[model samples]
Target: MAKTFASVGDLAEKTISFTELGPGLHAFTAEGDPNTGVIVGDDAVMIVDAQATPVMAQKVIERVRSVTDKPIKYVVLSHYHAVRVLGASAYGASEIIASEKCRAMIHERGQEDWESEYGRFPRLFEAADSIPGLTWPTMTFERRMTVYLGSRRVDLMHLGRAHTAGDIVAWVPDAGVMFSGDIVEYRSACYCGDAHFGDWPATLDAIAALRPKALSPGRGDALIGEAKVAEAIALTRDFLTSTYAPVAAVAARGGSLKEAWEACRAACDPKFADYAIYEHCLPFNVARAYDEALGIDTPRIWTAARDREMWAALQG
Candidate 1:
């Protein structure tokens, strides 16, 4: 039988958890779904990676309200993915911030991504119509930008490309907590549909240099303490290398995409088979790795039509 496209069959809702990593740093994780980070500063709050839709964001808002009544002053986009940014309206944040590359991607492929993602994971797009168009960043920075809410210093830095060309992480220096958005996923498959396979390992090295005490990853449970943080980073690195290495080798040899996919599945399934979204992400991940290995630097834009075509060719 042919495989389902993306996460179409993933209908069950995940349990939500608001875990405190530091004094004022929190991680809003929903099982294996996309995670959001909350940093409560003295005067205000900053939200990392908004949910998929306004309705879904409301849950985060409710959780935010539970602990700190401080206004949500900023909503940060870790990258330009529809599931991560379309919920900006619900926060009513004074500023929506993103990396300059992310803003450019929003302008380039935001609409197509919205259509493609919504079609793939219907459960994540609850009340999809509630999203007020594509989320745009009010402020964009190049390498690094720092925002201070009183004495708390939150650094938004683009630590090389991994998940996307625009991927950034929210680093709280004083608290030693890093909100690694899609750049480092723990117990979850790295979605490499629009990823930079060649640059990803070096990026992970940069993250390791930080030596964060606690790390809130893009998905899965929050990593608290130095050991867990290191473990998660290593696991993420292994997933990326394991998935891309075999696929890239096959592609470099002028193998067919189907052959590359089979090679990737064999290489990655032994360890990552039980990880979240492993099955859903494998096809797209292998396809992108194959392209990258064949010398495509920039990721091709994925539309609904392209998604179907790729899935059919790979799984049919």
Candidate 2:
């Protein structure tokens, strides 16, 4: 039988936690599962990264209810991912926000990605049927957009592509906090199937420039203080670098995928072997790194079929 995680089992429907990172800004994390950030301003609230389904999003809604009753006026999608955007409709926000490139990705491969993701991780999509359809953003920005929640300013900036082609971060300057989407995961898989490995480092540099006092990453626990925040950032960067370097080296030498997989395992399994979903992520990560090292700019599409084929080929 396939192994299941306790966190995944707990998140069967949805789980919620309310951590007050800033005065009115709450992190609605889901039992160590994918997290959602809630920012309450003077006039309205903004939800960062909707859960996988409307039913799933309701869990966040219930948590948000515990803290503030302000109407959710904006649903901001950090990027174009089914698990992140599919729950957007439940927000009933006046506007849905995303980067213009995010919209284009949804237009191009939303359906494929939806199918691919649901298949790869069935546990994360417990209420998959409740998803109305591909979530589309009503408002799209090019580089950045600033919205005011009363007097507080929320800056949404596209800090170059790492996790996806249109990845963005939510920066609350006054609070010195950043919601980094999947651009910075803690003790979890980087999900590089749709990532740009070559550009990810520079993207991390942009995030580090903010010197956030706290950060809510895509997975694991939230980074509380400045030192822990930097620790999380550095750990995520190390995870990516350690995993990629060996794969890139083997690829550069014209080694086969199997050889490259062994190389990556030798390099990363020693350090990040205990991390969550390391096995599940390594094949995809190596495949992308292999492509990039060979000068492939765009990542190859991942389907349910491709996932198994790559895993089998690389594992054996």
Candidate 3:
């Protein structure tokens, strides 16, 4: 039997855990689901990566309210994925911030991504009808921008491209904590549909140089110590290399995408088979790696039709 497209068959809701990594730094993780980071500054709060819709984001807001009554001042988009950014309205944040390239991506493929992702992950898009429309960043920066929540410094930096061309990390220097968006996933399969495989390892190296005491990854549990932080980063690196290398090799030999997919599955499944979204991400990841190896620097847009077409070809 053919597999469902993306995460269509994944309907079970995950248990949510809000963990405190530092004094006011928190990670809201949901059992390998997309995680959200909260930074409570002296006066206000900032949310990194909004949920899929307003209804879903309300749950996050409720959690934020439990800790501090300060208004949510900023909503940051780690990248322009529909599941990450469409919930901006729920926060009612004064400023919605993202990298300049991220904003451009929203303009370029936001609608198509919204359609594609919703079809793949229906559970994540609860109350899909509640979504007003595409989320737009009110403010955009080039490389790095620092926002002071009272006296605390929160640095938002684009640490090169990994997950997407516009991926950004939220660094809290004083606490030695980092909120790495989708750039790093701990025990969770890296979603490489829109990824830049060639540049990803270097991006992971940039994250390692920070030596964060606690790091909140895009998925899975929060890494709370130096050892755990290092482990998560290394695991993420190994995953990227293992997944891309075999597929790239196949493509280099002018192999078909199906052959590349099979090669990637063979290479990655031994270790990553039990990881969350491993099956869902494999086909797309291999497809992207295949394209990148064949000299396509920019990723092609994935519409809902393209998603099913690719999945059918690979899984059939």
Please report the TM-score between candidate 1 and the true structure.
Answer: 0.99
Using lDDT as the measure, name the better of candidate 1 and candidate 3: 1
Candidate 1: tens digits of C-alpha lDDT, residues 1-316: 2267789989998999999999999999998999999999999999999999999999999999999999999999999999999998999999999999999999999999999998888999999989989999999999999999999999999999999999999999998999999999999999999999999999999999999999999999999999999899899999999998999899888899999988988888899899998988898898899999988999999999999999889875
Native RMSD of candidate 3 (Å):
0.9
In terms of lDDT, the best-performing candidate is 1
Off by over 4 Å in 1: none
Q: Rank the candidates by lDDT, best first.
A: 1, 3, 2
Distance (Å) between predicted and true CA of 80, model 3? 0.4
Cα RMSD, model 2: 2.4
Give the runs in model 3 whose Cα sits over 4 Å from its true position: none
Pairs that collide in candidate 3 are: none
Cα-based lDDT for every prediction: 0.94, 0.84, 0.93
| Residue 43, model 2: Cα distance from true site in angstroms | 1.4
> Per-residue CA lDDT of candidate 2, range 72-152, in tens?
999999999888999999989999999999999999889888887787767778678899899999999999999998898
Q: Each candidate: how many clashes?
A: 0, 0, 0
- lDDT against true structure, model 2: 0.84
lDDT comparing candidate 3 with the true structure: 0.93
Candidate 1: residue 110 lDDT (0-100): 95
Winner of 2 and 3 under lDDT: 3
